[model samples]
Target: MGFNGIRPNATRKEVLEMIAVIMRDDNDLEFKLDSMNLSLSISVVTEIFWVLNWERLSALRFFAWIRSSKCRRFDFEGAKKMLDEMRQMGCDPIVDTDNYLLSSLCRSDKTDESCQLLEEMQERNCLPNPLTFEILIYHLCRLGKFDLVHEFLDRMISNGLEPRLTTDAAFIKGYFNSLRYEEAHKYVVDSSV
Candidate 1:
């Protein structure tokens, strides 16, 4: 920005372009540090993730960033090892991006695996909110986990999240697809009631 700044020679646009490259390159700390002489802060990481269109990043790479940021911020372990290494050197990953990965996994009928990821987040003190629980429960329902569906309903009620449109729709769709006409009609009738 000013004289003798690390990026003094680079225009603001170029600096942003460099950051974009670093983000796409998986936040190669060595390259970023060596070239930019800048520390990777939470803000920087967030900007990078957003610039990269967080949704486009692979789950593994996204986790890598999360783990990296965690390790940098609090020395927490990510869901993987290499990401921890990145954090060791100074990488702060984007939490929202990581949450999106969990959401995607939950929607994929990989609730068990998603649970593992959630556990990892919890270990890092990242407790999911109602929306996360809603997604997990909805996916479970879509996957035909009737028992778990009821269990989640109970949990959501206890958590003070009333059954929502998506929840009802998922149940209706699953019941209909399973040819449980009686149960589906019951739900429809109950909705009317």
Candidate 2:
């Protein structure tokens, strides 16, 4: 089937044609997918790969592209629900998975929810890594939430995790953006000490 004829219930052959058209366009894949309202799952994607009879390397690239596209959309409630379901199935995701969700929450301006997730992570014995701390601190700084920033910084240090230079830069930029020059200067001086 041609691109215009493609629908939600399109046959495998039609989906293949749509994929071919998308690849040929070399334009915005996400936009095309969005316009088409295509809801492709991993299984369907893998099936497409097998049907295409592509080499392993090509299939890997396609899979990565699909995953990246999906990751660009932040659906916090959907993610949380999926996580809850995973837990119910006695299948806890790894720390990295939680970190990804945390990053998504932060990016979506749900920093407060992200903080609650951090607490949940702790309760689950899932220790937050440096990236997790960085994600929270960066977004909190953007919001000028210095109190929570400092609290997390202290907690990070207590856990023997030194902030990255990017973290330091975030603090400086955040304070300067908020016109808290004195605090920024003090932070610089104290760090030197």
Candidate 3:
């Protein structure tokens, strides 16, 4: 139950070695990971996430594991560190990785931090995908941050991405929930035009 031979007190190096084994046995990744009884720290999870970045499926499975397991909560600092470490190693994290961080930040009610990270992602030339904008817009709308939501929506369109109908509904819902009935009505009317 120890990562398929990883000791309970395994160091970062050992955990990394285990990651290698997991990568090599890609077909059995879920089975191997599910069988392991490891409690990973934030830093270790970051490292493992970085290592799995290039392997989309593995990274996704690992991300799901991180979410469901008793692993430490991921924070903005951990995400920043992972990105910085990747840059130092002569690589940039993929957009999916950034999206994951954004989702995590938003779920934690750290929308401000997520916005900051979005800026950093742009500065690093890691252009965000449509999902990125959707994530931010959804969270911002939920928090009744219409100003930022509008801003992101504009940015999303400028990037040649159309806002999904769900996004439009979220905006309308946000206005309604905020007790701005007039604004919501106006929005629906104007959008129809």
Task: Give all candidates' CA lDDT scores.
Answer: 0.58, 0.71, 0.73
Task: Give the TM-score ranking, best first.
Answer: 3, 2, 1
- TM-score of candidate 3 versus the correct structure, residues matched by position: 0.70
> Across residues 68-158, which tens digit of lDDT does each residue of candidate 1 receive?
4444433232234443443554653445645666665664556777767766766765555656566766677677778877776676677
- lDDT (Cα, tens digit) per residue for candidate 2, span 1-193: 3333424455666577656744554556546555654555444654565544443223333443444444465546645665565466454667777787787788789877999999999998889888889889999999999999999999999999888888888999999999999999999998877
Per-residue lDDT tens digits for candidate 3, residues 1-193, read 4544434655766687668766786777666765655656656766776667756535656655554342234535745665576578665667887787788888889888899988988888889888899889889988999899989988888988877777778888889889999998997897788
Best by TM-score: 3
Winner on lDDT between 2 and 3 is 3
Model 3, which residues run further than 4 Å from truth?
1-9, 12-17, 24-31, 34-72
Better of 1 and 2 by TM-score: 2
- How many pairs of residues collide in model 3? 0
- In model 2, the number of clashes is 0
**Ranking of all predicted structures according to lDDT, beginning with the best and ending with the worst:** 3, 2, 1
Candidate 1 has what TM-score?
Answer: 0.48
For candidate 1, the per-residue lDDT at 2 reads: 41
